[model samples]
Target: MADATTIVPLNPDEEKFLRALGTVMALLPRVVDADMLEELPISSTEYTVLVHLSEVPHHQMRMSELANVCGLSLSGMTRVVNRLESQSLVTRQKCPEDGRAWLALLTNPGWKMLEQAWPTNLASVRRHIFSRLEGCDVAAAAEVLQRIAAP
Candidate 1:
């Protein structure tokens, strides 16, 4: 292993790429969240939770697992689920397989909410992300991102 105090300088291109990546990481979520809030009843994070639940079998997932997938702390996920539950969009139940754990279940109302919000989410994504990539190879970009994000 290299010495902890050793310094390796970044090339100009590498430095530029890192700067742009940091800015995008900071900006993208705020922009998307703003768009979602402007046109829909839900924020982007809430919409994400709904989308994940909708895609899963039985429209249910463990609360901890949901937190992981959503990139939220367990408490944060609980709070989001609480808001959804209050709106009658989702429900929390004891995990059948693990009594100590909780599960998040999408409700019929949640499906309706997702269906209603789909267009706005799609438009927001296209407008804020894909449109900016006009002539870029989107597939390659996605593959690179997936690799970067892999555990």
Candidate 2:
């Protein structure tokens, strides 16, 4: 009987792509966590959640939608909202249109945080990732990733 665990070889392109992805993955967290956002008023998780809310209509998104946009689980988003609520960065409200749903509302403080974080964040991203790529290639890659992640 053939052993299912026998090695399955990756094609050259597959191996190359995985290596490229691995390199980026290894560098991303260290840069983002250490140099980019540590001094910011919000953690990356909080910032991403706020950014998602900031783009929503009236800066209010139902909790479930916020979770999907932020790549967070429902309970994770709830905890983030709880922390932001304590800091007055966000407000939690019951959805008027759906009594069972909760909405995440970006507050004035949250907007201010976003304002301060946005430029610096972009700079860090550029220095770490975008600046190294050819402009056209970077743009094309971004479009591809966006397409893959589209709802």
Candidate 3:
């Protein structure tokens, strides 16, 4: 690791921006989690997994792929998938082409759950995020944030 003494502190504008970004990063999840817990049966993480699976061709994806898409560790994804499987929201099956790999497939109930949750999720996003910004603000923020978040 580099020596702490060599590091330069952020300038005031950079500090302000980072603080605001950190606040939003922390608070936005809580806001979304509260809405989800109140209006739906799933948490935000589960919703993310489901949404990604829903976007795929067959409502199914490899466990590792799902983990990557959801930004979860392999073990973390396994735990989440186990919970979802217990709830009958998803099913885990051995991959046909690869005997050692597993696939997570969304169930009918999962689809229904997602459908029911969509309106609540959308409203919460609007209430917490989009409502606070104008169109141009949203576009600019999206561009900037995406750039910052990109690998």
Identify the candidate with maximal TM-score.
1
**Reference-based TM-score of each model:** 0.94, 0.81, 0.89
Task: Supply the TM-score for candidate 3.
Answer: 0.89
Instruction: Rank the models by TM-score, top first.
Output: 1, 3, 2
lDDT of 3 at 91: 98
Worst 10 residues of 1 by lDDT: 1-10
Q: Indicate whether candidate 1 or candidate 3 has the larger TM-score.
A: 1
Model 1, 1-151: lDDT tens digits are: 8886796889999999999999999998899899888987788899999999999999999999999999999999999999899899999999888999999999999999999989988999999898999999999999998998899
lDDT of 2 at 30: 74
C-alpha-based local distance difference test score of model 3: 0.91
Model 2 lDDT tens row, 91-141: 999999999999989999999988888776777777887777855677789
The stretch of ten residues in a row with the least summed lDDT in candidate 3 is: 132-141
Deviation from native of the Cα of residue 84 in model 1, angstroms: 1.1
Error of 1 at 104 (Å): 0.2
Pairs of residues clashing in candidate 1: none
Q: Name the lDDT value of residue 56 in candidate 2.
A: 76
Q: Tens digit of lDDT per residue, candidate 3, span 1-151?
A: 8799999999999999999999998999899989999977788889888899899999999999999989889999999999889889999999999999999999999999889888888899999988888555777788998899789
- List residue ranges in candidate 3 displaced over 4 A: 1-7
